[model samples]
Target: MNGMERISSFIDSYIEDDEGLLNEILSEAIKNRVPVIRKASKEFLRTQLLIKEPENILEIGTAVGYSSLYMSNYIKPNSKITTIELDEERANLALENIKKLGKEEVIRVIKGDACKVLKTLPDASYDFLFVDAAKGQYINYYEEIIRAAAKNAVIISDNVLQDGEILESHYTVEKRNRTIHDRMREYLYKITHDKRVCTSILSIGDGMTVTIKLSD
Candidate 1:
């Protein structure tokens, strides 16, 4: 393994394993091939929430509600999370999981396409935004997310690197994935260049971007 791999492995070795019913369920979901946040990304998010202590969070994708539940552990009391999922099965599962955790009052799962659901949310409603769905529509999501975010909001975007393919030329990407690749690049460019946010792209967990919204 290279230097970065070695460093990641060392960090993984030192990270404590979570022991709880929710974590156990998350482990099972991962074993079943459900897409959840990677270890590094999870750690980054945990730290961010601890520092920001956001009162309201908007999550664009609720795969199995794992990330939402994981975040619930870190946010301040009375904080709320609104997560969107387009898949009916996943949305129902998410609700079940939230209810099981007795966090029904803390987390709400909205079943619908995020592109449409986001339009209904009022401006400056969320102090933190997590985007992890429909890579091709990231730019679209970003636009709506900015409208809904509070000034100085923290936006965490996952899978922005497309497994490192994003660094490769567009011609090198598979035709089927070119659209997503191009769109991700565009999204990165906009966030990094926009005066409204200070963005940092990190090579963690398929790549992640952390943006802090700035006042105009």
Candidate 2:
């Protein structure tokens, strides 16, 4: 089997039947090509965020707010989550979902370009960050994300493996996909080598890199 197929099998084996309602919504979203964080990855982020009990959580990509709401259901009371999205349609839908779930008080959706919105956040204030936005911008986003994260904060970047696409040389990928492949590789390289963050690339759904900001 190919790398992606192998990883899919692994995730399937370990993934459990948790969060039934969330899973149902995710399934519907997937059917409509409305991207949401993978079930396994969302569960992983939920568990980690619950443990961290972050006071301020910042999410770069709020794809329909599935992951944000999932984390909200598990995290400590009164913890605030600020998620950014560029698409107006998705943002509206996410806002509706938040209100439907009665999470509007805890989960806030900021409609704008992620990089631009991130600039307005105070430095070193976020205790946790969830990045699931454009693959080509992961490295660029990381720079800003780290600046916004608190000391020893946790940052999770989804789709780092890009379905094992990063393992292939850029030239081998289709011309249209080459740029994204190259950028993902560059992002992975920078994250792995950076001394300020301790990083681990897990062979989970599409691959996720979990990083912790080092205490200065």
Give the per-residue lDDT digits (tens) of candidate 1, residues 33-70. Answer: 88988888888899999999999999999988999999
Alpha-carbon TM-score of each model against the true structure = 0.95, 0.92
Highest-scoring model, TM-score:
1
Single out the weakest 10-residue window by summed lDDT for candidate 2. Answer: 17-26
Clashes of each: 0, 0
> How much is 27 displaced in model 1, in angstroms?
2.0
Q: Could you give the C-alpha RMSD of every candidate to the true structure, in order shown?
A: 1.4, 1.9
Tens digits of per-residue lDDT, candidate 2, 6-98, equal 766777687775456666667767887998777677768877886888989999888788888888877778789999999998889889878
Off by over 4 Å in 1: 1-6
> Native-vs-model 2 lDDT?
0.84
Model 1, 35: alpha-carbon shift in Å? 0.6
